[model samples]
Target: MAGAAIKKKIGLFFGSFNPVHVGHMIIANYMATQTDLDQVWLVVSPQNPLKPKNSLARDYDRLHLVRLAIGENPNLRASDIEFSLPKPSYTIDTLTYLKEKYPDHQFVLIMGGDNLASLHRWKNYELLLRDHEIFVYRRPGYDIPQHFEEHPQVHFFEAPLMHISASYIRQAIQEGHSVQYLVTEPVFQYLESSALYKS
Candidate 1:
């Protein structure tokens, strides 16, 4: 059998992105420019197996918000591949599908230190680390394990500390608070006009 074709390194940033915001974009942009990654794809998950289903907005709405957030950044992209897949999206399943569909593209996982600390609970977590590199950005206070330092595929990046989270944004919006400047103007408008995040 022939080996898969090689293409530019693409960073896979998986998230609920219930409503895409500036913090999300900043991490992506920083990764693209600071790391070896050539492009960053915001993989908007329909549902996360570990998170509450009720936490998410409609899959399409989230995807649309991601699209709006990226705007014309040629290196940034939004993908809704998880929506068409089975429910309770798992990182392993999504990564497997992406590898098959975009064989030419080399993929690296982008996550925060908090996620890394809990990655052992993920389905097929071992295979994920073995098959692809991980770019971990720092979170508020989560400590990365010492073993990760021994792994060749694990990389740590010190991105600006925004302390921003999707849940906080959602809470603020639901309470009729302004989300201005935290997200791009278009995404903020979409969230309000579409009445997303309302309890």
Candidate 2:
């Protein structure tokens, strides 16, 4: 008899994850449970073209933080695929590579309303919209743009939005404030142990 076929719908959540925080995990968990996605992969970007290079932590450190945040969640994973790819990683390229590598799995792009607003600025933005499905979670103040409000490939979810941000956490650490509930305990411990974000 033939082995069971490989068929899993994976949601790709791409971010720098300067230090993976609870907000990131909450959004991913919601997507995994509320949507048809079978799993969620937090694809850590080595360098986002739009972001400043100096604002990010080391690639491996960010990857490690993502892994630590995911912990034993069977349906959640951390990927360093972008690290091996070209610098200033682009979403379209990452999606294409993932599709080619995991032929049996359906990959959906997971992003926030803020990203949707700036989607047009992305490389091959039109191709990305036409080629893959995107799950956009609502952010605090950003609204879904009119152009993408009715897009066939775009789906919006009411995942809980947290005001917390990686930069905020880093600032707190640098200012000697408590970041207790902002990030996962393991990640917090790792950051402290490594003396990260401390200038």
Candidate 3:
């Protein structure tokens, strides 16, 4: 089975992209281009259906923002896999579903340093560490244990990350400030034309 079929290397980037921004695009593009990955999927974290409605359809809204942020980049893609999965999604569970769904694709987990630090606390984390390759991006001020770094499945990249946070962008939008450069042109245009986070 070694050379029976060439598997597609897909990087799974999970996030709650309340509003996808330029930073996410940059990192995703970098990972796709700089690494051996054929495509980098920005997987949107689904909103809990059981929770009370906040009047904002965050599940679909975030997916659209991610799509807008990615634009026509061939190497980058926006995925709403979690939106259809069980609520309170887990990395291992998502990985399992994706693996079963796409048998020819090898899914790699892409995460920030902050997530890496707390990965052990996640549900079925041992399975995640054992079954999938973990790609950690550069993040300031977040630290990880040396033992995990020594793990063969865990790899780190020096991709530069913007200090800007989604909360900051939301706050800026609420204040009626221009976030033209903070996000992609399409996202910025959409936000400008629509009342997204100004509540």
Candidate 2 has an lDDT of 0.90
lDDT of 3 by residue, 58-172 (tens): 7888899888888788999889888788877777788989989999999999988888998878888888989999999958887778997899999999997887777789989
lDDT of 1 at 190: 78
Which candidate number would show the highest lDDT if scored against the true structure? 2
Q: Model 3 Cα displacement at 1 (Å)?
A: 9.6
For model 1, the run of ten residues with the poorest summed lDDT: 159-168
Clashing residue pairs for model 1: none
In model 1, the runs with Cα more than 4 Å from the true position are: 1-6
- Using TM-score as the measure, the top candidate is 2
| Candidate 2 local lDDT, residue 31 | 96
Model 1 agreement with the true structure over 116-164: per-residue lDDT tens digits = 9999999999999999999999887788899996789999999875767
Candidate 3 residue pairs in backbone clash:
none
RMSD of 2: 2.1
> In angstroms, how far off is 77's CA in candidate 3?
1.0
